[model samples]
Target chain A: MTDTRNLGSQTSLPTKKLKFHKPKIGTAIFLTVWSIYVLIPFVIMFNIATMTPHEALQPFAFGWDEGIQFKAFSELFVDLCMGFTIFGAFLNTLMYSIPPVFIGITVGTMAAYAQSKLTWHGRDFTFGYLMFCWLMPDCVGMGAGYMWFDFLGWTGTPLPFMIPGMFCGVAQVFFLKSFMSTIPNDLLAAAKVDGLGDVMVFWKIVFPLTLPAYWCQIIFAFIGAYNNYLGPLIYLEDPATYSLQLALRFFSVFNKDNKPAVMAGNILAVIPLLIVYLCFQDFILKGINMGSGLKL
Target chain B: MEAENVEALEGVQAEIVERQRKRRKTVKIIKQDIIGWLMGGWPFIGAMIFGFIPSIIGYVLPFMELHTFDYSQMEFVGFKNFEWLLFNERSMFWLALKNSLYYTVSVPIYLGIALFVAVQLDKHIKGTGAFRVIMFLPTFVSSVAMSIFWQFMFDKTGGFNSILGLFGVAPIDFLDDELWFMPSVIFTGTWGACANSVLFQAALANVDISMKEAARIDGATERQTFWKITFPMISPTTFFQMLTSLVGALQVFTSLQLMARTDTGPNGAAVSVVLYMYNMAYQWTGPDYGLGMAGACGLMYQTVLVILTLIIFKTKKRWVHDND
Candidate 1:
C-alpha cells in the first residue's frame, strides 16, 4: 500500500525514483519450494491415510488406484480401542477444551475489564502479577500440579486439567487486557451516566466491543487445550479419560504395525485444528501479530 | 411575605434533594468499587493458588526429600539432589543439559532463515497472502502429529530416502545415526519457522517506508539501506522473537519424545531438559520427585538467566527506532 512512485521524489538528490515492481522469478521459485516444504507433512498424512499398509511402505504410492480408502477413518473410529475408542477420545478432548475456554474467557474478560476500565487499588500490581505468571513456563509447574492434584484426590479425572484452567489463564488475561485498553474511556463514562454500574457497563459495553479479541483468545485456548499432551499424560491415569492428543500417542504405540491406522488417527486428531486454522486464518494471524507486538 | 416564605421552603427542599443525591452518588461509587474488587479479585486469587503456589512448591520441592505424595513424609535435604545431578559423574543430567543447550542452536538457524524469507516476502508479490497461509499451515498442526509425520518421512524406507534413491545415493538412517539425529530434530524444528517468519513479515511491514526512500535517495544501496534503516527499525521485534525462540528452544520436548519414542535416541543426543525431567518425575524406575524437582529448579535458573539476558538487551533499546 506504500506508494513507491512518490517515495524518493521528496529528496533533493537526483536519483531514480523507486517504483513498485513485481516479485522476481527467483522470489517466486524460492517461495514455491518453501511452500511445498511446509505443506509436505499434510500431504504425506493424507496420502498415507488412504494407503494400504503394503502400499504405504512403497513411499510413493497415493493409493488412488483403490480410490481413496475411507476405511482407515472407520477403523480409527471403530476398531481401535485399548480401553476406549478414538470417538470417545474426541469427545473427551471436547470436554476438556470447551469448558476451560468458556471459563477462561469469562474470567479473562472480567480481569481485563477491571484492569483497563475500572480504577481501584492494587490494579497495576495485580496486572503485573498476572504478567509474571504468564512469563513462567507452564512445564515448570507440572511436578507440583501433579502432586497437588494427587493430594486433592483429583488425579485420573478431568479436574486436574479443567480446574486450574478456570483460574489461571494469564495469557488470555494479557491478550484481552491489551485489546480492552483500546476502548475509549468516554464510552464507559457515558454508560455510567445512564445508570449502568461497572459490572453492567462491562457486560453491555466492554464485552461486546472486545468480542474480536475474545475470538482470538478462544481459538488459541481451544487449540492449546485440544493439543495438550503432557497435562493428561501426567495427571490422568485412566485411559478412558485421555484426550485425542494423548490417545493418538497411545494409538501409535500400541498399533505399531498398523501405520495406516496410526496415520488415520493422526489425521483425525489434526482435522478440527486444521479446520479452525483454515476458517479463522486471518484472526489467528492477527492474534499472533498482536501477541508479538506487545512491548515488554 | 407569603411569596417569600414559599421561595424559602422551595430552597430548603432543593437543598434536601441535592444532599440526598450526593449520598446516593457516594453509595453508587462504593458499590462500583465493591463490584470492581469482586470481578478482579477472583482471578488474582486463582493465579495465587494455581500459578504462584505451585511454582513456589516446585522451587521448594527440590530441597525436600519427597518419599511419597504425603507432606508429612517429606524431609528437608538441602542441595543433596543438586549435588547428585551436578557432581555425580554417572548422571544423565549432564548429557541432557548438553543436548538441551545444543538444541538452542536451532533458535538462530530458524530466526535467520525466517528473517530472510520474511524479507523476501515483504516485496511486492502476487499471491503473497496465499503463500503466507501455505507457509504458516505447518505451525497449526499439532506437534505430536507433525512428529509422527516426520518420523514416517525419516524412516529408512521413507519418502526422503526414496527420493535420494533416484539420485543413486545410499539411504541414511536419519533417526538412528548419532551424527544425523540432532540435525534431523533441528530440521523438524525449522518446519515451524513459518510462525516466526509471519511475525517478522508483520514487523517488516511496520518499518518506515519514508526512511527507506530517503536512504535510497541518499544513494545507499539496497542491502545497506535494509541493514541501516529497516533492520534497526524492527530491532524490538527481533529482540522479542529472539527471546521467545530461545525460551522455546530450551523447552524442546514433544518432537524428541515422539521421534525417540520416549527414550533418548542415538547416544542421548535428542534428550531435552524437559524430556529428561519428565522421565525422572514419571517414567523413572521409581518416582524420584526430588530429582525431578532438581531438574525443574535447574530449568528455573536457566529461565532466570534468559530473563536477565533479555533485560540487558532491553537496556540497549536506544538503537530500536520508534517510527510511530
Candidate 2:
C-alpha cells in the first residue's frame, strides 16, 4: 500500500535534509567505556564471591588455580553462637518484612478505595496528607517513631516495623488507587445493582482486577522492609531480632576472623533479590508505569 | 361510605409498600458503607497513629529535650541543639550537610552521562534488553555488597589505583584523604545508580514520535530535537528522579557507613548527619540519648527540604510538560 521508494527518503530525509551533523565517534567511544565501567564492579563481585580472601586480594589476573570458596555459604547456615545465627537474621528480616507487606497492602487499598469510590468530604485533603508522608524523608521522624514504639512497648517487636510501614504505604495506595480508577465504572454499577456490597465488590471485583499491581506492591514493600537497616539498628537492640541488613552489616565488620565467608555471605544475601528482579523485570516496568515516582 | 373505606385501605397498602422499599434501599446503602469502611478502616487508623502522629511529634520533639530512660526529665532545649549545630566546631552537622551537598551535585552529572549512554542503547541496538538488565543488575546488588566491592577495589594497592597507573596517573589514597573520601563514595554510588537513568530512557522512548518528527522537519538538528522536544517530554521523569535523589542524598548512610568503616573511620570525616545521629543514639558505649534526640534534629532539615521542594514545584510550571 505504501511507496517503497519514498520510505527510505522519508526516514532518511531528516538527516539528508540537514547540512550539519555532530560526530558520534565520541559517543561511541564513551559508550564502550561506560559499558565496561558498569560491568567491571559486578564482574569483580562475582569473582570475589568465588574466591578466598587471599586469592580475592590477588590482582584479578584470570588464571589462579580456579579458586572457588563455595563453603562460605554452608558456613553461614552452619555457624551459630549464643543463640544467634544467620538463619535467625533471615527469619528476623522475614518477620519485619511480611507484616508490612500485608498491612501496607491492606491500608493502602482501603485509602485508595475510599478516595476513588466513596463520596466523602475532604477526600482530596486526605490524599494530600498521605502524599505528604511520601514526600518527607522517612529518617526525619525515626527518632519520634522510636520513642513511640518504645512507649507502646514494641521496640524490639515486629510491630514497630509493621506499624510504621503501614503509614508509609501511601505509595502503594497511590499506585493501586490510580490503577483502580482505570476500571470501567459500569462494571461497578452492575455489581452494585446485583446486591453486592462494597467490601465484596472490592474483594471479588476490584482486587482481582488489581492483583498484578498488588503483587508489585507486595514485592516492593517486602524488599524495602527487608533492606531496612536503620530502623532495626535503632529500634531493635537484641541481636536475635536483627534484620538481614543488620546481620550483613554485622558480618561485614565482626567477621574479620573470616573475610571470604563474609564476601560469600554478601553474595548469598543478594542472590534472592536478583532472582526476584530477573523473574519480574517486566512486571517491575509495568509497576513503574503505574507508580512512577514511588519506585525505590 | 363503603367506597370511601375501600379507597382508604388501598391508600394504606400503597403507603406500606413504599415504606418497605425505602427501608430496603437505606439498609443496602448502609451495608455497603460499612463494608467499605471495614475494608479500608484499619489501615487508615494505623496510618493516622504511626504515620501522622510521629511526623507531628518529630517537629515538636526538636524544641524539647527527650530522654528515653527518664520521660519526666523533659525540658525545652529551645534551639540549643541548633545553636550547637551552627556554632559548635566539634559537631559534624555542618560537615555532614556539606557532604550531602556534594553528593547531591553528583546526581545530575552522573544521570546526564547515564542518560546519554542509555539513549545510545535505546536506538534498538543489538541486545538492548540484555544491556539494560546488566546495567540494572547493580541496582539489585545490596548496598553492603557494592560498598565492600568498592573498598576492595580501592584498597591502597588494589586494581583502581593499578588501573590509574595505566594512564600514568599516580595512586592517590582514596579512603584516607579528607577531600577524596566523599568524592570516592559519590563516584561509587553514581556508578550503580545507572538504573534510574535507564528507566528514564525507557520513559523517553514512550515520548510521542510526531513531535520529534515535526522538530526534524523544521530543519532542527538531532541535538535540537532532543533538547527542545524529547527532553521536555521526559521532564516529569527527570523531576521525579531529582526529588528522590535529593531525599536519598540527604539521608546518605549506607555507602558512607561502609566506606568510613563504621568501626574504624576517623572522628567524623565521613560521618553524615544520619550516621552522626546513629552514633549519638546507639554507637557510643553509654549512648547519649538526650544529645542524640537533640541532634536527631528535623526543623532545619525539614525547612531546607520544604524550600527545595517549593523551588522545584514553582519552577516545574516552566519546565515540566503535562500532555493531558
Alpha-carbon interface RMSD for all candidates, in angstroms: 3.8, 5.5
Q: lDDT per prediction?
A: 0.77, 0.69
Pairs in clash, predicted candidate 2: none
Candidate 2 lDDT over residue span B1-324, tens digit each? 999999999999999999999999888777655655555454456668887777677777777765544657768877766776667776666877776676677777767766776677666555566666766666666677677667767766666887887788888778887778877888887777667766677677777876666656657778887887778777777777777777778777777878886432554568766766666555653323453353445556667777887787788767667744
Error (Å) of candidate 1 at residue B167 is 2.8
Chain B TM, per prediction:
0.83, 0.85
Off by over 4 Å in 2: A1-36, A57-66, A80-83, A120-122, A166-168, A293-296, B1-32, B66-68, B165-171, B263-267, B285-296, B321-324
lDDT of 1 by residue, B133-194 (tens): 87777666888888888887888888788889889889999999888998898998788886
Name the weakest run of 10 consecutive residues (lDDT summed) in model 2 chain B. Answer: B285-294
Query: Which model scores highest in DockQ?
Result: 1
lDDT per residue for candidate 2 within A16-65, as digits (tens), equals 55533455565556656766887776566666666666665554333336
What digit string (tens of lDDT, one per residue) describes model 1 on residues A1-296? 33445555554665565533533888888888988888777777888888777677765555466567767788866745488677788999999989988887888889889888888767888878877766655556656767766777897888878887876476778778888888999999999899997888988999999888888888878888888887888777778888888888888888766778889889888888889899989888877787665775
True contacts kept of 2: 0.33
Model 2 error, position B175 (Å): 1.7
